[model samples]
Target: MRELRGPIGVAIALWAVVATLFHLYTAGFGFYEPRSQRSLHLLFLLPLAFVLYPAGASSPKDRPSVLDWGLAALAVAANYYSYAQAFRINLRFENVTPLLWPEIVFGVVATLLVLEALRRAVTPVLAGLLALGILYLFATEYMPGMLNYRDMSFSEIVETMYLLNGMGMYGSITGISATMVAIFIAFGAFVTGSGTGRLFHNLGTRIAGRQSGGPGKVSVISSALFGTISGSSTANVFTTGSFTIPAMMRAGFRPHFAGGVETSSSVGGQIMPPVMGAGAFVMAEITNTPYSSIIVAALLGSLLYFFMILVSVHLEAKRLGLVGCDPSEIPPWREVLKDIHLLAPIFLLLVLLMMGRSPHFAAFWSIVAVLVVSWISPRTRLTPRKLWDVLVQAGNNMVIVALACAGASMLVACLTVTGVVISVSTLVATLADGSILIAGILLMATTLILGMGVPTTAAYIIGASIGAPILIQMGVPVLSAHLFVFYFAILADATPPVSVASYAAASIARSDPMRTGLAAFRLALAGFVVGYSYLYTPALTLQGPVLEIVGQVLVNVLGLVIIAAGLFGYLRSPLPMPLRMLLVPVGLFLTLFEAYSVWLRIPVELAVLAGLAYWPTLLSTPAPVRGETTRRAESAPD
Candidate 1:
């Protein structure tokens, strides 16, 4: 094992160097031919998958035995043969002839390789799911319900898998991954290497480190910034929670509360703008919307999510009598500025994106900017060795995502081949009976359920393919349909029973996993409002008139504050039960729907304000017995 390690590492290192150059030229400068670019993308995966083999196999039980290696080798050979056949067919323009022997051979091998790689990289559950999908595809004639289809010949299946058809792995999934997604992953690596992550953490700490429940609030803010860029809930939790959770504990928060706060905040990252995981890029490609618009919508959701967290933290602080960190302990402003240059890449990327450039170009240049800027400051300089390490690390990181994309592509291919997406869409529309509200709820549930175990990008892609069509057909705008599915897909990270983000936090805090998951759900209630609001208030989506948008934004923000206060059970002090319960429903109504009549909403709005104002006063005034005691004490003062 040790002898093979050196050669494998060297080979992986060489792949990184070549892939980096390829990405820079193709993604950065946009100079590669289409076929050449696709070939490079496929070749880049070989060394990456090999290098990750060891790390992904930590336990003896996980070690790939001789049989496993043989199967893997056979699979790779099959995949290559398939690609070669597909390339030939592309060259010939022969109307997808199923008599293609090379195509059949390639399909069989490629399927085996993907299934084995999935087993080695992800989980058996995913592998099982893929196997079931393939089996069902082959046995379509025997299946019942919407799943039944005419039995495809072996050549027909091979043609679907290998040819330049939409069902093949080289379609949209890999298309998006090789272009936009890969560039952004590189962009994130560049930014993290440049120390922008630390800058965000420091800024969050400086702004929110010295108030009641300050540490918890800081966690919310810092995790949001980190997650927005990193776009993985588990990564977000580990990155920001390491500091924020400890700080929250020191500031008198229970372990469970601290963990829940970090978990809930971190999960919001996949829905945050700019670098929002690989899903945002896929969202743009699938919906035909500008990447900038998706980023804006995600940013709105992120802002509302973090605001809810802040309000909850503030109320918790008041209830618990927690104090902020000492002023002397806060980092100096000038010191923070020393690392401010780290932010240049992100700002530059955003500006370029807003100016209508491709995300690939934006990410490529942003990476260049980070490397160049880091060289200017000795404190952030990346030496040749470090640069190589970064490349290797980036390549390694791309493997799981790349494989998942490949697997998801199969699912997409199957859906397209069977026309299952249209079938499912029609089924959902029928079930909802054309009610947008009912359709939205059912779609949301489907997204969250499917997304629980899958990566956010894969889940979002699948959800958008199956669910978005239904919503769009129901007269929902394109952006709203996509965004709605995307939001619920992200919510799966924090959703109960299988909340991966909450589990990460639970491990860190040594708290009960289920309890932390429940707490996270409570902390993230406002996200539900934001998700539903996208359906009702198109203005919040920047789709309507400016005045109407402003009004929607104002009402949404106000409603969020009220809901946060109610959920946390405190405004100025412990809210009386009656007012807390009253505010919860009122806030939900105003936040979820802008269609409420003025006459109906005005009365509820007035009642909410009255409750907010009177609750504190009612709590502050002394009882008659307490007043009598105070008078007696004054008369008998020493």
Candidate 2:
């Protein structure tokens, strides 16, 4: 990102502030017609991307170069034309009318500019996917069997991807970005500007500072809280992990383990309720489900996700004989409680969401509540300068997401026009041979592969566009299918080789990046199983009878405890290797096999695992391993 000086910097800042104000205004009042609203959104944001994100690493970092200005001018021209013609374009039957020369020229310009801006702001993966999508349009005639589709002409492709109101840069995906997601991003900026992130950290340290593995637990707690508003996992890791990872190392955690704990916790925040990053809004849009219902359904799985991480931290702490920080060094709970009013905006947002208000409506009011609550305590107040910064920062933060939505819209347009979505669904369903489990496994692998190196929102969008339909074809509920893809897309952040969040935490902890990635992947294994279980039984998502939901919750909790013990190699005491190895499969069976009576399985599984975990204490005190003394070395500075 650049740091321009003189009039250029001021002008860029004003553009960003205006973009933010546009979303805020529409959110509180009413939105314009769809194309008008979405086009105006792109008009504001795409040009900002051209100025802010350099074309390459060698590109000018301090100011816009000639090419940057030219690109910005082109972006402005294209999006402005789209905005001016939005109403007239919407009235015409798309692809039926021959394109006017000006529409063709601007359409082509808008498409290329959006793709180039996406490549600059985000990774090139989505752009690469768009390239492949267009290639597929031409290649469809040559595809064999279920992969085949009718060939589309080049002009039709451009019209569908650009001029069509529901398909391309102006599609529903961009619509979500322009409205609901944009409002929430602003809400996050306001919340952070009000010092809520600091409040969460102090509150977490106060509440969990005295527990076993307290520093590690604090990471899990604080990251989860901060992750709510800071929707990006990498951002969450850098913000919370900067403090938590070092604290964990100081409290006797190995550097890699500390990185792993922070990575897993931060990723979980993307799946956390109320504001689950940008993906949840896209999921709500794709599934045509209410945003409130999506969050409610996701609540149990998210709670269980945190439960697994905490249990892993506790067990690992116990195994390593780690203790809490000195009480004198920790803040008293009373001091932390004074800033609790900072959380009121989040609570108000949740209440409004539950009351069935539109997401943009809820977010706008929450932002107002943040400004009001910030003033109640001067320490956390947002001044005029801070408010301006928040507005600019919100626009800056929104660039990647808004462009991502626009980019993914082009890809979805390709798949929809070519009929590849349905074809791929049929192919996967056939490959599964009528087994939902096989279908799920295939799609999960696909989602993980697609999610690697991609942001959660884009990953989920691509995964859902291709993967969700496959599961739905095999009888999975719409909500269940999209969420299944959603979970794995998030899990990809900690998966090795391309674990973006883990590598981020590793940089902070000064650990080997790959080792930290592996540790995070291991810590987050429960999330994978949870995704699978939900696919088989919707009860895990609170979609079944009351008793079934209650029973599944209890059963799953017991199952996770067993799995955590096995993974961390501890429970009541050091577990024998065979017993620890055996616990994992048994726990998985209990969690994954939902056909048995939940009432019957809960007690049986709990007893079996509890006895196994506790048996070592009954036997006798186990001898300490060699080098135990050396393993607990004090943390080293980066």
Candidate 3:
């Protein structure tokens, strides 16, 4: 495989920087401009598309061939032309007669480009969905039942695909990407540049490395912290798991358990606060809520998730009787403090956001902070070359996100044009027959299934459009509905059958992916219950009176502990099978409904207290090991 020459690498880097700057400019500045200028934001991705082929490749086979480059260039050009034409026309046509042939041509090329880009950047499943949606667009007239749509000529279809009326590449996905999504991504990149990643890892090690399941706890804490800045679950797993997975294995965790721990914890990052997955941005757009509110809700979920992970690690440590690292090996406080300056960027970002600044402004200034902070310590200072590299890497990362956004934008566009969202929502509402819980369940199932292969942003947009309204109609709060779907969408990454994060972790641990996925599912049981709790108890969402919210939080925390203990099957010691079985359903009932009959609640509470009290006794008992039992039998027989 031939490596990229210095000049080529530099060129690719410049292209990415240019594209990102264009996106930032259009997103942050174009809001006051005419609609046409706003639409021009689509062109920002063109240079990014050009650079991505070279940037993503790492080998001769991976490198973009001449033909690949040509195709990419054509796609970008077509996308630009389509956006330009749509902006000029501005809904002037009532029918398809006034649409231009160039629009149709662009649509075809853009569709092809989106598919190829998905194949290169994401997984095959996403690519297939894009193809399927485009196919549906072309063959809508022949479909039967609820999927059927009005027949349109090829030109009409192209016109619809290229238009800017809340559908097409210029609609919700790209619109949000242009605004909040880009800013947060930039914020994350800048924080990373300022060395927040290292700080998180070091802090995680210091806080958790003295425990029995120290490494696993470290993975959970570090991954959750990393998720605050790096919203991508796959990236989170590789970054923290590379260190923690091996450590866990060395500390005596089974390969599958280690992999499952990392996978589940890494997947939690998407639901973390501040810079959650792109899905949160889309949710804000669709629901018309402040971005900060979504961040708050996600923060709540993340806290619960990380707490559960910590409990799991602690219990497992107790079960295994493992020891902590030697004190001599621990890093000194003074050394850890030396890099504390790196945290300035993140602190500034949070403060700016809390102060009501736009995410774009917050991100831009935070980048400046990162650059300045990096120079404060000579050891961590970014050379001019490294600064340029950070800019370039930021751009490269944005391209993968941009292309996925564009493809998802196309899918969303189709849903709008065909009125599929309304249709699907109507069908789901009818199925629920006015029950909010049933409607939410149906929506949850749908999002989970769709999200298995689709990116979270796309899944959230699709689910929110189709599922959220049903919940609202059934009396569920709008924020709760959208957040519920978003939570389930992220959980799909740790879900069975097609759990991408689990598969990645399994590869690293050399374990069975299915088993690892199931383990992750078990560990994440509390999250699933929390999803239902949002519907049952709005207080968990910070919506009720202050006192009520506090009380609800207390109950919810207790419920989480009960569920965790039940799932682990040990408190201070191994729980009896009957007791474990009983606690599971009791925990779910208390958590999900928040309404426990006094009879059931009192008995269950007492039983849990008794179990806790008996924990020490259980652990102290000398249960015979399998090997010990075998030796005693052999000696007796002789």
Where is model 3 more than 4 Å wrong at Cα?
A: 1-5, 24-59, 82-87, 94-97, 597-609, 615-638
| Each prediction's number of clashing residue pairs | 0, 0, 1
Sort order, TM-score high to low: 2, 1, 3
- Tens-digit lDDT track of model 1 for 277-396: 888888888878889888876676678777888888888888999998767657889978988888888899899999998888888888888899898777788778778777765765
TM-score between model 1 and native: 0.91
Error of 1 at 260 (Å): 2.0
Worst window of 10 by summed lDDT in candidate 1? 54-63
Best by TM-score: 2
Question: Model 3 misses residue 266 by how many Å?
Answer: 1.4
- Write down the TM-score of every candidate: 0.91, 0.95, 0.90
Compared with the true structure, all predictions reach lDDT values of 0.75, 0.88, 0.74
Q: Give per-residue CA lDDT, model 3, range 316-355, as digits (tens).
A: 7777887765565456777678788988887887887778
Candidates 2 and 3 compared: the better one by TM-score is 2
Pairs with backbone N, CA or C atoms under 3 Å apart (clashes), candidate 3: 168-413
Local distance difference test, candidate 2: 0.88
Model 1 residue pairs with clashes: none
RMSD of each predicted structure = 3.8, 6.8, 5.1
